[model samples]
Target: MHKYYLTHLQELESEAIYIIREVVAQFDRPAILFSGGKDSIVVTHLAKKAFWPAKIPMPLIHIDTGHNFPETMEFRDKLVENLGVQLIVGSVQESIDKGRAVEESGINASRNELQIVTLLDSIESHKIDAAIGGARRDEEKARAKERFFSHRDEFGQWDPKNQRPELWNIFNGRKRMGEHFRVFPISNWTEMDIWNYILQENIAIPSLYFAHQRDAVYRDNTWLPASEFLQLREGETIENKLMRFRTLGDITITGGIESDADTLEKIVAEVSATRSTERGNRSDDKRSDTSMEDRKKQGYF
Candidate 1:
């Protein structure tokens, strides 16, 4: 399909493949941060295509929040086993047990933020010079300003203002010791683009994305599941909602919307017609408008 005639999604796939090849040609030790999320799954798909006859050269790095859905873990295990790729798990629970981070003290408490410590530790422990992620620009305002080869200091802190100019696809990954680079291949893709690409390539995603009925409680303009962390307040009420998750994170933070878009075509149509951003359902960003930027500066991926 790589010919004179270029389709939009084909172009995006070609670009992503090019970036993956670039990373393989450039870095000595690189790893893909896989969260079993849709974006990361797409990234993993591209990695497989990047080296078709040969195995994927990079390892899959998972930052486990310890509050992840069981389905995601099962998918992670299967994908790693099938792909024959090395899986490096970074556990937030270990960080908490080591007193590096403390568990929150409320009903709605979560271990999402504590993942940063584990992620950084994994990087250093594995001696990974570069970490590739599936972050897209259109996902968030702060993420929109990210560079393709974003640099992190010894402490894994991201400096927004100080970044190398990515002119004409010239990526500067040069760095001193104790520093590493983050490579986001699909930086230009939108949510719609992602769906269209998936539809075009016929890539398989986890089953949780489709429609399902779950016992949920309404709170703070989001339908949170009846997980152990979620508590029914004095006035809050529980309901049976036909819901599906738009974004996956800590069980306490991720939100679901009433949906019946079970098929891929229906999902694409629904997402295209939607008005809100994907992170709208995520309670972590609700802390403040600048919360994401603040967290990124503090080395929270």
Candidate 2:
């Protein structure tokens, strides 16, 4: 007798593909939110695999905070061109210029929160009924409560307590007009799972993920990249250090950790031995315990 069972990675892949297909079937217009981060890259790859021989049926959406790393923008353009997929950029700078959103003040202020307005405006302009993202439950406490098919209001607001439940593999994507949904295909994947999948598939990630020498400052117990967008505090001093970003976001607030894990194998080993969550180094999350929750409530991606 022979019994067949899928490995953990295979299971995750299968689940994600199924979610992608469901989005195609359920929504009139759907798009994958591509941030050029590892998670979004994996999500886009799954979308590609989900509909082989046929190009992915949806465009990729990017909410550009305008404070992005140059490397991230380069990667985004190259990937979109290689895939031959449509790319939509929602510019926070445009939102600010148009007075739809205001920039935060002070040295620690980041445009991370301002992205919500641009994201919603883009969704409305494009008439996208569903937006697929690479968000994972294990990344944060607020995200942990997100459903595979998360429902949003006409204003794109997310009510965590009112989310639809997923039983077995069944997902309900029902919503009213002027409203939309946020679909997370990789919601079940973990940091280790992402690294392992990337390693297994030999996916290309930004060079910032690997160890390199960069000018950074130690603040709030994390290595904040020293960029022109970053406003240094009084006591902070820029110094060259070997570091790698555990996660990517606005350059102003995203922090890196000191490490020499240049190769994927070393990165996997480092992740396995680490005791901190990936978002621990993110200054945006450090603002308050409920910062992510509050943002999600206001329709942040």
Predictions: Cα RMSD each = 1.7, 0.9
Which structure among the candidates has the greatest TM-score? 2
Task: Give me the runs in candidate 2 sitting further than 4 Å from their true place.
Answer: 1-3
Per-residue lDDT over 171-240 for candidate 1, one digit per residue giving the tens place of the 0 to 100 score: 8888899898888999989999988888888888877788899889888778888876677899888899
User: What is candidate 1's local distance difference test score?
Assistant: 0.88
Residues 154-206 of candidate 2 have per-residue lDDT tens digits of 98999888777789999898888999999999999999999999999999999
Q: How well does candidate 2 match the true structure in TM-score terms?
A: 0.98
Candidate 1 — which residues are off by over 4 angstroms? 1-3
Deviation in angstroms for 271 in model 2? 0.4
Name the lDDT value of residue 173 in candidate 1: 85
Q: CA lDDT of 98 in candidate 1? A: 94
